[model samples]
Target: MRGTLVATGVVVVIALGYVLSCIIRPFRDCWVCDGKAHHRSKRNPKLSRPCRWCRSTGKRLRIGRRAWNRVRRVQRDA
Candidate 1:
């Protein structure tokens, strides 16, 4: 019984991880900044600029093209 329970838990965890990955694959960068949003500057005391990578979007993609490619590979495999 314990073995069965463990197996079920493993499947659930894998499914949840896959679901989470799919949930955030569309946007290129942070959901808020689209990878370009920015906030006020602390050093300048009066400067504001968009984020180069994420802008205001908190999320950052290390390799956007690679992520897209992974998605394609997943789709093909599926």
Candidate 2:
């Protein structure tokens, strides 16, 4: 029982940290382009194209933030 309590507390702390981080920094660098906003061509390094994943913005909404937005929208609509 004691071990379970400690494990639960650790999980809660990690979850809270993730939530706070999502709130403080809602956007993260695009994984595909690594925030460069472009991808170099395989054949020619000089040629590059806009990142499709981030739509050239070099950032993406964190999953938690997206979920939060969805929840807010649903609540507002309801």
The lDDT per prediction is 0.66, 0.96
**What's the true lDDT of residue 20 in model 2?**
96
lDDT for 51 (candidate 2): 98
Worst 10-residue lDDT window for candidate 1 reads 26-35
Top candidate, metric lDDT = 2
Q: Give candidate 1 regions above 4 Å deviation.
A: 1-4, 7-11, 17-36, 55-78
| Candidate 2 lowest-lDDT run of ten | 23-32
Collision count for each candidate, in order:
8, 0
- Candidate 2 per-residue C-alpha lDDT over 2-42 given as tens digits, one digit per residue, 9 for 90 to 100: 99999999999999999998989999999999999999999
lDDT of 1 by residue, 1-78 (tens): 999999999999987765566566634456544444775578895788766556456665535445767889999999
TM-score (C-alpha) between model 1 and the true structure: 0.38
